[model samples]
Target chain A: MPETIAAVSPAGLAPEAEVYTRAFARVAVERTDHEPSRIGTLRKAAIDRFGELGFPNRKLEEWRSTDVRAIATTTFSFEPSAELVSEADCARFRYDNTHELVFVNGAFRSDLSRLQELPDGVIISSLEQGWREHPELIEPHLGRHAKFDNHAFVALNTALHENGVFVFFPRNAVVETPIHILHLGRGGDSPVASFPRNLFVAEENSQGRIIEQFATAGDTDTGGNHFTCPVTEVVLAQNAVVDHYKLQRESTDAFHMATFQIYLGRSSNFSSHSISWGGGLVRNDVNAVLGGEGCEATLNGLYMVGGTQLVDNHMRVDHVAPHCDSHELFKGVLEGHARAVFNGRIFVHKGAQKTDAKQTNRNLLLSPTALVHSNPQLEIFADDVRCTHGSTVGRLDELGIFYLRSRGIGEEAARSLLTYAFCADIVQRIKDKSVRRDLEEFLFRRLPQGDVVRQAV
Target chain B: MSLLEIKNLHVGVKDAKILKGVDLTVNRGEVHAIMGPNGSGKSTLALVLAGRDTYEITEGEILYKGEDLLEVAPEERAREGLFLAFQYPVEIPGVSNVYFLKAALNAIRKHRGQEELDAMDFLTYVREKMALVKMDETLLNRPVNEGFSGGEKKRNEIFHMAVLDPVLAVLDETDSGLDIDALKIVADGVNSLRSEERAFIIITHYQRLLNYIVPDVVHVLLDGKIVRTGGKELALELEEKGYSWLEGEVHEEAVAHA
Candidate 1:
């Protein structure tokens, strides 16, 4: 692929950037009826921002370790194979008694989705449908928290995201069942690309849980390369409690880049678990902002990768209010020649006194060749705040292995048991029982003695 | 034939030799107590018997059930009915104790051409064995030895012994950190497991534990060699005189040979 510096502008642009720029124009012209809508203005501004920023190069501070040039120069067509998906393909991803909303190649599939009659104030639908039906509810919080002024990927997703899930609950609307949004990537004979946007809004005093997962639907290996770029935004009002889970297990031949942003109101409690069984190349940014006083946030993550896969997780938590507490725990387990990066930053503002924040990142390398880069940073401007951060990257516990081997477990089985044991604490922390079981299933699926582990654990 | 035979055994770590020219023999249905000071090689002998590879055996031959014990791997040694109750039991987080024991017992049973025990049978088996040490049922569901008290850890090792039912059991300082009551409980647990098919080598720093479970033979080890061998009365003698007297005797023997 040639770096076709499109003479469309003074500055040189890569093939993908140029292609997306042209695609954005065609989309803008096709939506002539949307000229007077706020979405039109948002898209226009996002496109302009994408044009200026282009795709991030290695020179940028954040993208220094993760190289995106492989996908940046390759030309990707927006039209992908809409592989015939049935209820069977979606069944494997469903947990017990969840309101599932399925998407195929970034297109909403109501046929595979199931949502029972919810309470009067709760709204869960496709963004395309929600925008058309409940514009009053979708207008205010769509692009408010996830700003796209400097982030090129977020800007591109904001401009071109076709469809995604929209979950909204008004004040005090309690939902008993979990809302699951499942995204399945379908590859074709050529490199295919899609942008999925998700928005979640929880009003005052509401309680709920959400599980957003990404996986491949059709022929994952034989099919050509698939690029999935997604951006998700969640807003929680005062006194609401929510538990969110994101499990990303894309095909190894695919590229997954995502941005998950969350906003919390006064005294609201929110927790998110981001599990990455990474694709070939993945860069996931999970950021949370505490905007009100007395709020609590728990952001935990686990990433396991093998082969030559590269997974980078960048996390940021902002303590903007007084009497707020935030906890971040991210762990990685790498095997083969896989490499992973973990960057956790906790930022406390000047006036945010009485802030309590903790961050920890641990990595276990199963093979001698595997590599991990872990960095946990704290930037506190408040005097009365308590903050601590720690990181570790090393091999599995040798004594633990010897203990098991001496107990009649073979060496291989001992390692597998200990490997799964390393992930058990995080799995046990999942508040949703079914989701925890599902995570357990995924964690053990790749292990050698999975049945033995399941039986033993 | 002896259940275990160690001839001219020497074990060392790095440049330091922990055991030198040690010779011992054990028969079935008998309990042997090995008494020594802190720096003696009692634990080294126990660990080497369990096939821990950290210690280098420069010149030694250990025969267990007429097979070269050094050639077998640790797990194979366990499967062949050899057990070691570690002085400091290893704490493994996230693996339940019940599951660990069941996997171990099934492995042993399978090696002996027996079928694996299902969960129901295993639970029944475990509850019956728990009574040997007065173990709490709640500890069975917790991680193996993690967050367990010192006494609980020792009792857990004995519980493992009862479940595994090994042919030769080596206890390494099981009574080091236990109170008198806990000591009696562990001794009772060990005594109840003694049968014609089983043998034991109990390593201890104190003679108080021997009061509860009297050994048929007592060996005094000094400077990596078994310097004295006697009946259970030797434990009472060591308790009355302490190890300094034994050291003085060995020193006088060395001087006389010189």
Candidate 2:
């Protein structure tokens, strides 16, 4: 109804046009019912902004490693799932000890969710409710953490997503239990696209943990293509602590594009761990801002890519305040024709003195054909900070294997042992017992054979 | 008949010979101490005997019990009762010490055609062995040799040797990093595991460890060949006289014997 929002004429473009001028027309009509009215206008504005800037290519330094042509040329229809998720199918993902929050097709399913009792001053509600009830609290920090201009996928997530989880902890509150939210992809027999967004705000001196899992419940071996576009933004207020984790295990034929943005206030501690297990082509964009002095941020991730899958995780940590510390460790195991790319960047601003940042990206190649590319970059503007970045791409240590075999461990067991060891450093740092146990078990089952481990994908 | 025999053993690494025409024989229940200066092929001999792939045998025949030992793989050789406590134990991260030892022990047991112990039984078995080395129960649950002190690493090796219960134990400079207290514990562990059916090759540079676990035969190795073979007192003589005493005639005698 707004005059600022424009609808492209049907004659101007096909329903599957590759370029934005024609493509936006189809996406606009297709996502009309799902996209909120206010955010839809904002999305149109952001699209116009991108049109002014144009698409970034290899010429842009940041886009050198990741090519957007493959994603840009792929025509994905904004279709929703026709078949609803069943209770029995959801049981497959249920953990023994977790407060489950189920989201099917980007909409919350209250019947499938099990919310435990919350302490005083804690709020867990839907973003749709927040948009109407807590507009002041939601509007200011909704899209403030991540820079939408840098990435098209995140911008698209912002424009189309209508429903998501909104979590907020009041000042000085300590919520001991971890909140688990499982996002299920359940659009059967058609090409479906979902945009699920999340916003978490930890008030001053508050403490909590959130575990987010994204899984696909469609035919993986069949040619059913599902597209999932997700965004999660977390804000840690002064002296607050947050442990955030995101698990992406979609159907092998699905396309998953996700973004995780976090902002830390003074003396706050924030840590995020991401695991990418399944997807036809998956890409994760994570950005964290160290906004205050003495803040600490840790980013840990493990990804296993196999077959023809292309999995990429691009992250940047901005050190804006002095005396801040950030530690990042990402491991990949790749096999078959799977390809993986990791680009981790640490930016130490001019005023961010006394900053200590350490980043390491390690990859293991199980197959000679599988490809892995890791680029850990450090941009230091301040002379007083200590920052180090390193990337290692190698096969399993032959001597270490021989040492184990000489002690009577079989070749298979020995290789698995060392591969587990390679990933243990990151997995051990996760504080949540249930989350850590689930991930460790998942990794153990998948470690011995996978493109992600073989190729360090 | 000897329990182990090495005939005309010639081993090399990267096309360079490290052990040349080395011949030795040991019967059951005997402990042979091979001593030499650093880089004088002491560790190389131990590695060659343990079937490490880093070295290729140009010409040799190693008879263990009866079959050819050189033809077997290192792990198979280990299954056949050959154990090597490395001079520098390799650190295996993520794999707990207890898990590694349990797998190793089970592999050995399977090779001996015995029933495998279950998880609880294996834990109990290792608990008793841990006490032999005075090792704490907590260390067993940790990553193998990760963040372990040098002495703890040596003690873990001996503890593993006890678990595997190998017929032939080769301790290569196991006492190098150990203090007097750690040395006594490790030596006591090795002594307790000793039996008439098991033979040991204690490889060391100094005679200090020999004072703790006295060997049946002490062989002074100079320039890849044994220059002298004597009793336990020979270690004390070597400690006092030093290898410099055997520079000229000892070298001549080794060459003549070869």
Candidate 3:
């Protein structure tokens, strides 16, 4: 266990910390009868840890470039339910023929969820219900994969999370259709905050795909300021394969942070796609651990930020066993006064020989005011490791633009075509045709000059 | 009127002059070959005619279809049916060949007040042009010229010209890196595209390409000026004697004029 700072009183903490302390106190008193339960005990330990460490500051090396001081000092009250969200607002993100699980304000809404004709050996339910019905499967993997001792937001989420999605794929079960979990944040009359927690477990020889998306309601005038902290834990057994995609489309005034912890067993394959397009201040922490030999992991991310938004993606792939391979590519397009940061780390342990790792981070700034900080690092304790990392920050390719224009494409349309081409490789990597098409349309709609290219082409 | 005309055109790059005084005229239904040693401004003239912004037109005028061509933008020039097969074709990594050609075709068609072709019609048209250059069908789905071999890139340029069907096609050393087979294919494609309404300006250092696509007229360029103009026999003469004979003639002429 990592050492924790001394716990301080509510008055001595920051405003946001005080709010969390008060919220945890109320929840702790309400569940006094269930104090002896395992979840209750975990919650108490997590709240205690949160009180000890408060919120991470820029003093820590990991938090040096990404300062959460503004988020930590803002006072936001916990809202168990939001009243303004409608079914229409959620319909825009729905796909065809998939199991849909919806959560509003961090609370499960069975009326808004659709789960029909699931295959055998598959369980899809809310976390609270999963714990009640399938404790044997949920208890062993819930908080075990995601360690909260060193992460303040994870600890905070573990303590205050009300309900989120729970997925379990038993041995040898292959899910053909994807499972979509939509977490909608709707602000009420006052500033609100919610902690969403997810647990995913795939047994041996199982294959599955999961899409976890977060968004806000359409009306901005009624939606007050809010903060969202989510934590997801994934455990893959031997020979299991899973593809997980997370799309964050929060409101412009919202502060969102999420931590995803993934563990891969022997010969398991896991791929993660993290696409972020909204939120005023957003941070994503994705860490994968290859616990067995011959495990393969691929991480890809694309962030499009404009206005005053700030987005950060911090990823780590740990190779603990030999013959494990990991590939990561994270790209960003920043405009206006927006800023972005990508820090990718790969670690090969002492016995993790024959480890092959490649990491790349590229950023395209559309404006002079936009900025990006990309750092790709590798730490190899083994001798026979093939590791490579690179990063680039620049504008659109001028020659490519000229080449397009010389073909009779307008100047603005040429710029848009080149920018879309820059992002085409990452989009082409998605296996699902429908999802890839939808994402392509969504990204193209956000471009400043995509309209012209769309009309001409 | 001549289809294209250049009257005492003087162009420069920054401070140095590239083309001192170049005068040329090409009528419809004719093929003109410009033969010169390296750095004789053959490629520069092609770039300037295609409206590349790198070179400044210090003095003189260029007339395309009896209009002031210098006042037009690069894309406008392209829309006006001026095509330049680049000396070094650019490799665009993510724009597919089919999509790029379709976009360019539609833009030019719209400028010419013609209806745009649908996907089916466009593919049909493109497939026909692709066959003319003997190009593989798989190359159409790939990004523009990306990962193509030297010969493939040159073939792709001629393939594009075949699809666009430009009125004035400028071939700038199209045979530089091509093998004999590829050079034959390119020449055949250019030959098939020739018509009474179209013309070509084939710029080359080697006279070997002229053997395949015989030129109606050949101009020998020296020191940014057309030193001599003759019939197709001049290309065969230059091929046998090399550029040294022409260089000696130009030196003698300059000495006698002085």
Candidate 4:
């Protein structure tokens, strides 16, 4: 390969780029004696791309609202491989009898994972392990769905990605239990950054459910301003069905930027639910493309922010084949000085006739200072397509509050009930009973007057 | 002692004086019907009694159970055994009927030093009271008054009155948008809740509802003040002769006083 490194100028790359460069050099030297691998080549190409692109600026249309200058300025070191996490740390998020893969600071922890009693043809393991054991099954679809050419964050993640969760469901296999992936970020004295890359593939005629959870360790002081940039790629083959969920509850001072790219085959069905509750600055980019005819996709998200938090959700659904349908619903509740942004776009190609797409974004501002910006767009070129989009930003209904209060419910309880009710529609869309119940409980406890509402209910 | 006493209550909404120096008193076991034309401040009286802040009580004194009612908040008033059946019931989309009623009952019970009922006990109590308005069981699980028809919403108000079982109930235009059958069912529900320790103030524009739930006294409210007070037969007389007769009588009284 030709030399791709340019001279470092005074204002060229960010302060954190030096750390990534040093880490990449160490990894390359360590793997020098090993056999030539496709992942190595991909990593080298990604590092070159990252060096050229750097971090996205505010002038970019996609990064207009979200500013990552703080992240670029802060020096974050890559966490070296270590056994820093314990089983007790993972106890709270574990579910019974379901397969789980745990990652601490972006490194897979096999000691804390439970993969017994998995169904036949179901592969649930760490990404590094999967690449070593079943490279044939992992190589063809690993980085194909999530293209990092244009996205600077995706490029940076691909360049620094080490170990994360990998799940595969073979053809004709149906998994009854959901696979859980826990990404736990831990920080010490210095700020740490983790690039977690996850790949999920459901072969033809298969069915599966994946729950990806991102959280920090206990206590706010422990995680000292860490950064988590995760990228997930999903592929659903012909006649396959998959339900994907991403629950992000990082530390209050953390920065979270995630990208989810999905591809749907012929007659395939895919749905993703992203619930963001914590983090100082969070932005999620979710895109789904219908590659074959008769495919269906559903994207739903809910974000609750308070106390100087900023959360943004940007989604795009592309109808590339005829007879494909996609639906999107995103709701947000913001309080204090928190702000939120929602941008949803639906595109129908010229040849993709009979496409049906609907998008809706609704936000509730709980305080006078809380604000939200919503933009819903539809770009349709097909003459025989039905596409509709809407956006709304409002406060809690005062009359509704008075109605509840007149019935002897306290003002605090009434307000909390209304807030919960505002997000209930999105919570009800989750198909798993346990997941829905857990999310409801989480929402109830997260609201301002949650205790009062919980007791009243 | 009277259950409620409004002495020269002067109320206004924004710039308009809706109720000008209205006086009324209601003792336990008495149903007082205040009939008036449109924009005559009948609904305003009910809302003011319910402690709604929309109306400005410029000069008034309202005593409920020997305590000042204006000093109380709306939720506190509800917990103090005072209920107001709204003319237009609000449709709260996410709160279920059962949950709202249970919360109201528990809040009131807690205020009265009574033990709160569990889910099972609450269901049993609610099932028995729901029959007062002949409400369907399916409606209990649905959101509070959401997508309910006008008649169904009126029936739900009455259902809430029956369930809450307040010491004093203010039914504001409860018979406005109801068919004959719904009117009868609602009137029956109201009658079933009447007791020697309970009082009711029914504000309406029509005398037809008084035929079903006979009131002890009939008061004609013209503009703001009460112009006439008579026995239950006064409603029939007002029905036979229209409200124009009362207006003429009020004008004659004013001329005679001048």
Itemize residue pairs with steric clashes in candidate 3.
none
| lDDT (Cα, tens digit) per residue for candidate 4, span A1-457 | 1122222335766556666777777754464232237667777788777776667766667777888878878887676333666887788877676788888888788888888787788898887777777888888887777878777778877777877777889999999888988888877677778888888989999998899888887664345577899998898999999998888888878999999989999999999899988788999999999999999999999999999889999898999999999999999999999989898989898899999999999999999999888888889899999898999999988777777777787788888888888887887788876667668788777766675555543
| Candidate 1 all-Cα RMSD | 2.7
What tens digits encode model 1's per-residue C-alpha lDDT throughout A201-254? 999999899998888875545434678899999999999999999888788878
In order, candidate lDDTs are 0.86, 0.79, 0.85, 0.84
* Residue B69 alpha-carbon offset, candidate 4, angstroms: 1.2
- How well is each residue in B1-258 modelled by candidate 1, as lDDT tens digits? 999999999989999998998999999998999999988999889989998888999998999998899999998998998999989888877788999888888888989999999999999999999999999999999988989999999999999999999999999999998999999999999999999999999999999999988899999988899999999999999999999999999899999999
Q: Cα deviation in Å at residue B154, candidate 2?
A: 0.7
Give one digit per residue, the lDDT tens place, for model 4 in B128-245: 9998889999888887888899998899998988888898999999999788999999999999988898999998888889989999999989888998899999988888898898
DockQ-based ranking, best first?
1, 4, 3, 2
lDDT of 3: 0.85
Q: Ranking by lDDT, best first?
A: 1, 3, 4, 2
Off by over 4 Å in 2: A1-38, A50-59, A68-70, A186-190, A218-224, A449-457, B250-258
Candidate 3, residue A52: Cα displacement in angstroms equals 3.3
User: Candidate 3 residues A1-457, lDDT tens each?
Assistant: 2323422445656556777878988864463342237777788898877877878876667777777877877777676665556688788877677899988888787887899788897999998788777888887887788888888899898888877878999999999889999888877666667888899999999999999888887753335457889999999999999998888888878889899999999999999888888788899999999999999999998888899889999998999999999999998988899999898999999999999999999999999999898888899999999999999999987666666676787777887887777777888888765567667887668865675455433
**lDDT by residue for model 3 over B1-258, one digit each (tens)?**
998999999999989888989999999899999999999999999989987877899999999999999999878888989899888888766678888898899889999999998899998999999999999999988988889999998999999999888999999999997789999999999999999999999999999899999999999988788988999999988889988898899899989999
By summed lDDT, the worst window of 10 consecutive residues in model 1 chain B runs over B88-97
* Sliding window of 10 residues with minimal summed lDDT for model 4 chain B: B91-100
